[model samples]
Target: MLYLSQVLGLVTLALWLYCVFDVITTPDTLCRNLPKIGWVLIVLLFPLIGSIAWLVAGRPERTQAVTRPSAFPEYDRPGRFAATSPDDDEEFLRRCRERAEEQRRNAPGKPQDES
Candidate 1:
């Protein structure tokens, strides 16, 4: 019985140590919003409750692969024109519209223009 208790204690200690090491060495990206050292103290000082806290609060969130740029990606990047809008210039858009119409006329299945 005493041997069994000793073995159980050793197992618990090993689990505690592993949790400590894992939390401490985990990178910020893998651990979400906590410092590794902070995890160490929590797991060390309060074992059961702290480990539970780490499980619930410190686990990493999975990020999805971003396949394309967002429709409004320009808002966050650093640039001189970050606050400006191309739509503010009407003349620039008039030329663009003319070019689009020209391309559409040249595309397949388009009827030829008649004077």
Candidate 2:
């Protein structure tokens, strides 16, 4: 009987400490039924009963995890632009080809016969 009482006392102490800590750590926005300070006071003062009440009435309800949509999912990628298709910028490609042909013609080492 004495041993059972000791175990129960330890359990109650653990529960009380846990509840107090929880109340203190819980965010003001998330706490229900009362403000964060109120919950902290209740848990601190009433131990087991307050802890039970906190669990039932003051604890934040579990919410579905929210997944935010990316503002620019395609363009947000690292080292990549929003425009993935080269076909969208045909003029840019045309200028690049013209520059490459002009450079080839101006090469100092190349024989004139190749032209």
Task: Please tell me which predicted candidate would have the highest lDDT against the true structure.
Answer: 2
Estimate TM-scores for all models: 0.41, 0.55
lDDT (C-alpha, whole model) for all candidates? 0.73, 0.84
Candidate that scores best on TM-score: 2
- What does the lDDT come to for candidate 2? 0.84
* lDDT score for residue 31 of model 1: 70
- Off by more than 4 A, model 2: 64-115
Report the poorest 10 consecutive residues by lDDT, candidate 1: 59-68
TM-score of candidate 1 relative to the true fold: 0.41
Tens-place lDDT per residue, model 2, 1-115, is: 5698899889999999998888887767888889998888898889989999999999877672334569978766788755557777988789989999999988899876653
**Could you report the Cα RMSD, in angstroms, for every candidate shown?**
10.4, 6.9
Question: How would you encode candidate 1's per-residue C-alpha lDDT over 1-115 as one tens digit per residue?
Answer: 5698898778777777777776876665567457777777889998767776776787554463324566987765776364346698787789999999899989989788896
Candidate 1 Cα misplacement greater than 4 A, ranges? 1-4, 61-115
